[model samples]
Target: MSAHSWDVRRLPSAEGRSFLVTGGNAGIGYFVAEQLAGTGATVILGSRAPAKASAAARSIGGRVPGARVRHVPLDLADPASIVAGVAALRLESLDAVVCNAGVLLDHPPRRETDNGHELMFATNHLGHFALVSWLAPLLAAAPAARVVTVGSLTAKSVTLDLEDLQSLRDYRPKRAYARSKLAQMLFGFELDRRLRAAGASTSSVVTHPGGALDSLTPSRPVRSRTAGELLRGLPAGLLVQGKEAAAWPAVRAVLDPSVRGGQLWGPRVLGLRGRPVPEPVRGDLADTALAAALWAASADLTGLAPAAAGPAGA
Candidate 1:
């Protein structure tokens, strides 16, 4: 469908398909899973907390009757957990995997993962890097698979420092978070280039959830917003939107047959609040050299080989 004609309320059918959404138990990820579940597709919620994941799954089931939803234990900051999570999935093939889980620390004392990498960089970029690498074979096994990388608008304002990816030298919370997201966007674009060159059937697409506010979101079993909170969020709602709306870009990227690899999708109005639509990749996001460098660094840090080339539609 054309971008102008695409409708968020009416999604394309995804019957008999399966998708894995990292951090699918809460926030925008939870809504993404809920929306996808409405299409009759099996939605696997990759989360670290079993209780939260179960609650999110029940919420989805209640909202969409007969919706197929399950959870796999996943902690993006831990490589061992990622491996175990992927292993635990029973599916022989996956239609898509949304790299949506991320961390943004507001205040300061820098934190590191057990692996010794910065928390934001490790979880936001490297964790997904490793997960995708491990899931590569399953993605290749599908008729046509998608890897949707969720980026951030914060990335547009900051430049990635390849030498200081972990932010050991200058550890401002926001900047570090932004740079990590920038690195992820670079990885998505670079992965698509490599997939095309290798004739792989899998495609990498990047998307951003413009500006989502929890206060503006509709209530669910997993998260409930009080009337007072909604009232306070009214003014901001004119500019931004709720987390349910934030899931649009990622959902469209996953289900829209016309969406091609290396393309970007996001909120249509001012790239902030409205229907999801195709958006132009700009500035550092379009830099091939930087993407390649980031890809090499990611591979080295994660100790995963570059995505293997396979036959188209393999």
Candidate 2:
């Protein structure tokens, strides 16, 4: 099926299915969880703060009656948190896992995660990589499952440095963030290839919430409301989009049964603010050599098997 034919607003029923969304406390992640929950899907929100997650869950419940929204404390900056978060899921089955948690704010002076990897790389790419690796069995248990890794438009401006995968040599905030996003795009497509080769039913897809701003999120949180006003006051509002609209591509990528593995979706207009559609991937993002190197590096850093990285026992 083509992306032009799909309507993000007309999603299929999600009753009886289960999904896990990282960073579900606020922003586009919260709205994604809200949209899925409104359709009767049970959403497990992975958040770093228990209070925020609980509050987000309560907000979803209030907005969508009978919505099943739960929270698991997930700190992407720490490898231990990822392991604990997976374990906290209690080996339960999942239909999809939206790898949406990311650190967009550029941390100057180069921060490192608990596992000693670059902070942005660790949180944006490696943490999700580990979560998906650990949850492979659960995803395979489902008749059909998907993994949606959120990519970024920033990736188009930078190429990943395989040798300096962690950006340890010269750590510039924006460069590291862009490289990490590129890694996510590469890892996501590579995961699909590996999953297909392994004959697994689970598919891996990537998407970018084009020009989404926290300042425009629709939730009733004080921060969102205040920022929403601030955003409207600025001239950038002409180009920026709300988090709800920005989430359409990701929502489609996750729930659109017609969407295939390795496919990427983004805003149709200017690849920034518009309806969700299939956007062209960067040429270098599809380089097999880089993909392989990234997969190997991810496995080594996360201490998982290279070939058995994705869904198992398909």
Candidate 3:
């Protein structure tokens, strides 16, 4: 189908394919998983909470009959947990992985992971960096596998300080969150560059949800928003969108054949609310030098060398 003709409600079929979506237990992640399940593909929900993941899986099954869905424990903040999660998947190949899990701290003193990285940066960027590095082999095994990184509009306003990625010098909650997302976006672009350089079949793609509000989301078995809540959210809905709509860009990135690596997918209207489309890569996200620096820093911090795509089954 043409890019202009792409339809969110009627997605292309992906039968026999398999995908993994991190943070698939709630919010926009849940909707991404649900939509993918509707496409007749096996969907694995990667999350820190087993019960929540299982519940999300059940919810998908309930909504889409014969949906192939399951859960794997994955805590992005913990490298060991990521290692365990990939092992638990036990897959010879994977078609795509949506790096959708992230933390946005609204308030408080700054927090750090067990490895001493800032909480937002650790979970939002570094954890996925490490996870993708480990999954390189599995991704290589598939035909044209994709790593879809879900970024945020917040990154457009913030800047990254390579010297202090963890914000050890000055920690403000929103700035830290935005910077972490910026790093994630940069990582996506850099990963595509490296993949192309290595002649790897696996491609990296980046996308942003635009403005997403839970209050505007459709009711689901897992979490239902009251009518009153939706009514109150109507005003914001004009500027923003529900979590279901927010999942569109990432979902399109995963399934759209026309989408290419190094492209940025986002909302079409004012970049805030509308159907997903390819958007211009601007600002820091377009800075290759900055991305290269972030990639190097990520490798050093995560203690993971970039994984080259080896021969299938190698």
**Candidate 3 residue-pair clash tally:** 0
Number of the candidate with higher TM-score, 1 or 2: 1
Ranking by TM-score: 1, 3, 2
Give the Cα lDDT of each candidate.
Answer: 0.93, 0.83, 0.92
Error of 3 at 203 (Å): 0.6
Q: Model 1, range 1-314, lDDT digits (tens) per residue?
A: 89988889999899999999999999999999999999999999999999999999999999999999999999999988988999999889999999999999998899999999999999999998888988988899899999999999999999988889999996999999999999998899999999999999999999999999989999999999999999999999989999999999999999999999999999988999999888999999999999998888887787784375221223
Model 3 ranges with Cα > 4 A deviation: 309-314
Cα deviation of 114 in candidate 1 (Å)? 0.9
Q: Please give the lDDT score for candidate 2.
A: 0.83
TM-scores, in order shown? 0.97, 0.92, 0.97
Off by over 4 Å in 1: 309-314
Error of 2 at 46 (Å): 0.7
